[model samples]
Every structure is written in structure tokens, then in C-alpha cells.
Target: MNAKFMITPVVFSMLLLASCGGSYSSNSSDSTNSYGSNNNSYGSTANDSNKNDMRSDSKPMILTQKDVLETVKSKINSDIVVMLPKDIPLSSDSHFLSAKTTDAPDAYQVIFYETKNPISVNSDDLKEASKATAIATVSGKSYMTEQEAADATGHMDNVNTGMNGVDLGSNITGYTDAGAGSTFLNWAEGRWSMSVRNTTSADQQDSIDLAKKVVAMLEKETLPAPHQVGGMKLEAMPNKADGNIISWQNDKTDYTVSNFKDPLDGVKITTSFTK
Candidate 1:
């Protein structure tokens, strides 16, 4: 069977940090506005009645990390595992926009923003109305096998001339690619191929050091094993003014944690999920 695993692209340059305090039209698609470089804008949509109800409330509705996870769980099949951060390091000002399944039935996503306004169940004007300090997402989808999933993460465009070895301490020797203001440290654990990147830094040592720290952490709190092979990618780009992103796969599902400021926090969020 043809493997259907694809790595979600990380578009850091186009991220918008705005408040979600404006009104949204109810006619927008359910998955139209979100925080990413996937050509989709960031905003919320709500019916008129729900909008009025939200406007009357003095305090905006706050959805905890657990709340969003539950919401996503309800939308997808119970057999498909979903993972998210146990606790986000953001302030209390963050508001959950929506949590629902994507175009695919087996896939699900949840979005939240660091804003002070309440997003209605149907609020549509989130793209132009809110000022958010940061945007984050937790998304998951199913795949066939770990090896096929791992192979899909290979990015031909990122190939560079500078290369070195990265020893992850488990007899698993990874490699580093440095060039064009970008550095990447890549390795594999069991059936999982892992990589950590720094787009703004070409320092090979920085990528290697961060990779070591992340690998040490994974040794203690492990991720769910994949059936065959899997893939994980972490990125740190402080100059983008947007959040960092971390993605991985396990069993038959591919998971992503995005819009975080720190790379270490991304790893913490990924390991927080349980079977």
C-alpha cells in the first residue's frame, strides 16, 4: 500500500500576533482561519446569537490544555491517539479559538491564542479583530507505518554542503547539516527519525547541543512506540517573531505541536501525552 505520510510545513515568517477582539462573520468555513503558514488566516467565526452572548459576558472563556484535548478527542475516532501539552507556559490571557477535526475524519486540530477576548463558538472575525502575543496548535493524523512516515520527512530543498556527525548517546549516530543561515541535527530512535533545526543560526554546535539535551529528556519520558518507523522535527527561530514548531509520529498517527517560543518546551509538550 502507498504510505500517506506528509510533514506539515512550518511557515514562520507569516505568523501574525494580534488580539482576537473583533467580530467574525458566520459564513466562513469551520477550518478557514488558524495560526500557521498553510495559507489559512487566523480568526474565529460565530453565529449572531452566539456572538451577542459572548459580548455580554465580562470574562472571556478559557479552555485549558485538557479541555482542548477532550474537544479534539470527541471529533475523531476513539482508536486514533491524540497528544497535546500537559500545560502550556503561556500567561492566563490565552483564549482557545476552536477544536475540531480537519478535512480528514481521522485528523484533528486545536488552536489557541494569547488574547484577552472571548472567542464565541461561531465567532468569525478573529483574523482582523484580535491581537495575540503568540499562536499555538496541536494536530494529529493517521499513517501506515513508521518507516514510510519517517521517509516523508526528508526535505530535498534543505540539502546543504556542510555536514557533521551527531552522537545521540544510544549508539544512534545522527548527522548535522549547516549552510545558508540554517542548521539541522538529525538522528533516529528505534523507528523514529528525529531532527532539530535552527533557521536563524548556522552554528553546528548549537544544533548538536540542543539535540543532545532533547535526546536526554526523551530517555526519561519516552514517546509512544511506532509500529514500524516514525518522524519528528523541531525548529527554533527566534528572529521570526513567531512561535517554534515540533512534530512527531507514533503507531499510525502523526502529531504536531506548533506556535511555541522555546524548543525545549516543544519537547516537554510532546512527551506529556499518554496512551
Candidate 2:
């Protein structure tokens, strides 16, 4: 069977991240973003001399069920799980923006989340908003050696600079920025990159508390696999009306991505094939 998995926007974002670097968006309009580039190991150098074309005739990459399965399998080992506290009175619109897994010998998975809590925002109440809004992203990576993992983390220095460093023991390390009202922290549980972040005017301590809660919740929760419809195990995503999201279809299945309370479980797949 000649099966081609249509590229959804989520998958496209993952591909872009791999080809380029990661990108982040926020609800804060006045927020200033910065990322550091290294010239040593993580940095790149320019080669002035050019040679003959070494390009080969390669077929366009097509995603398949096997590829989806392997990607989901890599996510099963991720040490991160996003679950907001019941007492926080969060918005029902909390959602997982995108998730992707790639098997590059060093298999890895990345998931992004956007969450918000109901709060009273007054123009004079706080700096940006009266409530807490954040984007929590987790990346589970497998490296060929411990040295590779160590080298990859070096870029984090640029991420944590100017923020107040928070020491949550040896396993968890992070920083809190009061000016930006953001808390960023990540821990390496083996090869997995687990992170918890809070971007709000809430206290730095609040961010730490949230991080602890996430770590505790993740200890008991396992990432859910993609949904299976008919005989094909397709990647399940939420529904969004904004037309900003991407949609895809295979010969047997079609996926319309959207925003929901949860990425994996929030949006229900209701198709003629699903009974």
C-alpha cells in the first residue's frame, strides 16, 4: 500500500524546529525575548570555499503509520506531564499546541502547552495582566552519549541568564525572573528534558510550587498514545475554529487539529469510522 501521512501544522512546526531552532510565543505583548547563540560547540562556522553540487536525487519524505508509532513510542518515556491544580481555577481552554516525535537513532519527543487561569486583570492591577499565563514545553531526548546531553544543555545558560536561579535540589535546576514575571526550570531525568514554567506576576515561590506539583504529578502519569481509528493509529489533536492551525488527511483517515483543555484527551475524535 502506498500510504503517505499528510503533514499537519504541528508536524510542520516540529520539522521547522529541527531544521531551525525552537521558537516561543506568548500572550504578553510587551514581552522581550532573547536567546543566546554559541560559537564554540553549539555554534556554526561559515565555509567560504564552494564545491560541486553534492545533492542526491532523494524522494520526498512521507510519514506513515510506522513513523507515527515510533514517534509515539519515544514520547512514552518522557518524564513530563502537564496537569494544573484543581484549586487554581484554570481556564477550560488550556491546551497542548503541538507534539512530535522523531527517531533519529537518538529518538526524541517535544510537546508544547498553553495554559491560563481565571483572574481579574485591571490596567492598573499588575504589570502585564492580572492573572497567570504560561507556556509549558517539554522535550524528551536521547543522546548517543552523556557528553552529547551535557553539550546540548549548554545553551540553557542563555535561557536562564538575568533570572534569579532557583535551586530545587540537584535533580531540578531553574531560574525565576521577577521583572518578566516568568519562572523557568528544567531537570534531566536521565536523557529526558523535563521543564515547568510559569509566566505571570505571581510570586517566584508560586512558580516553584507549580514546578513541584508538575514533577509530582508526572511521577504517576504516563503519556497517552495516539488514538486508533479503524485500523490506523493516527495522531489525535484538538479542534480550533481560528483557521490558524493545520489539518491533514491520509487515504484512510483525516485529522483536523484544534485547541482544547488537553492535547491528548480533551478533543474527541468523532468520525464515521469511529464507533
Candidate 3:
């Protein structure tokens, strides 16, 4: 399966500009918003504090509402594209998920994703897609799996650098184009997943919205896409968790640490890792 981080723009109507006053076009160069009184960086439930379900830690993470807000706040101001929340822990039996907003006052981009075990793939590694997988067809590229989409592009040293939007990859079939911000990664459904959503960016509203969407999915505990490798309908190893069937990165650290308008632009990069 393919993992993807999405940089989707919030669709708003221009006719409502009189009440809202802004042309929300999808551009990467919009002036960022400030953490002012109108700051919607923190989700309404972000400060609830009582819904503590997965934040348990051994180091006693002193996570205060203010601290969480501040961390998210910094990402909002720094023009970073955060895909998940902060300090999310990864696990084998559980999935970690969160989202940060990247919509500057002048922008409205958001990233979304789920957690899974990272698969190891070498140059010769390739797995077929499954029916459960909802392929995304952005531009003209077809991402059969989420990982293919996640690892497509973006320097995830960490940020909202993956596939974007909901039910996005569903219509994508045969093939699609990778956007400048496209990225791919390997992920498992349960066993390999650990603190899935790693939020680190300078954007907020979009981050919050992404987080909400992820949390909403988490509430239902969405499973990974099933597999059907090599013309065979695989049953996901019986009881084992489902995740990216093909995944692996090279040992060559010659990676390009940068962002893009179309994530596919970086495909020219060659990895040092070989099978």
C-alpha cells in the first residue's frame, strides 16, 4: 500500500467575499496568519483536556493546553505544513493520528493521513494494489496505495508534505499525476503503527481541520487497505495487521530537503539504498 500526505486547499466561494473578503486560491506563497485573538489554531476540542485517550507517556509529557496550543501556534506562524499533531506516539497494536493547519490568513491548505507500520522496500521491491485501497488521482497520477502517495514528495524532516483531502484517492484509477506537494511512505494498520500523526509545522487552521478529520476517522478506527498482490487476493496475513505492502528507503542521505508545488518534481532524486 502507499502512504500519502495531502496539501489540499479549502474551497471557498468568491461571491461570499463581501462577508469573508478573500480570494482563497491554492497558492504556496500566501502571507501567513498571526496567532491573534481570532486564532483558530487550536481546535475547539484541543483544550478539552478530559478526552485524554492516547497521550500516556513514560517521560511524563507535561502536556498542558497552553503548551499544545503554543506548539501548534508555532507551526502556524512558520509557514510549515503540519500533517498531524505533536508528540504522537507510534505503536504496534495501535494507530497514532493528528493534524495541524497550514492555512495562513491568506492561505487555506491542509494535510491529512493515518498511522501504519513503515514497510521496508528496496529498488526491486514492488507490491500490487488491493480493492480496499482508495487510489487518489490528483492531476494525472494514480496512487494505488496510500504509501505510494505519501512518499511521492515533500521533505518530511516533518510538515504537511503528503497527499491531501478526503475520499481523494477514491476516483483515481489506472494513473494520475503527482502534485508538487505529493509524498509517499510505508505504513501498517495496527502492529507497525506508532504515534501515527507527527505534527510539526508553522500552520494552524488547516492543521486543526486535518486533526479533526483524522480524529473523526480514529473514532471509527479505520483499517488499512487490504492487499491483493500478484493477481492473488491476499487475506492480510490472516490476523496480522494490514499496511503498505511495498515500502523501503535508500541509505543514501543525498535526499533533497525541500518543498514543491508538485511533489512529483522530486522523483528525479535517486536513492542510495538497493536490494
Tell me, by lDDT, which candidate is best.
1
Clashing pairs in 2: 238-258, 239-258, 240-258
Error of 1 at 12 (Å): 92
Off by over 4 Å in 3: 1-61, 80-83, 90-219, 222-275
lDDT of each: 0.56, 0.33, 0.25
Task: Tell me the deviation in Å of residue 26 in model 1.
Answer: 56
Higher TM-score: candidate 2 or 3? 2
Per-residue alpha-carbon lDDT of candidate 3 for residues 51-161, written as tens digits (9 for 90 to 100):
454454333343332354345445553222222122222223343222233444322222211223222111111132221111111011224454543453221322222
Question: Predictions ranked by lDDT, top down?
Answer: 1, 2, 3
Best by TM-score: 1
The Cα RMSD of model 1 versus the native structure comes to 27.1
* Least well predicted 10-residue stretch by lDDT in candidate 3: 266-275
Clashes of each: 23, 3, 66
lDDT of 2 by residue, 3-23 (tens): 335556668888988655433
Error of 1 at 34 (Å): 52
Measured with C-alpha atoms, the lDDT of residue 115 in candidate 3 is 29
How much is the lDDT of residue 17 in candidate 3? 58
User: What's the residue-level lDDT of 201 in candidate 3?
Assistant: 34
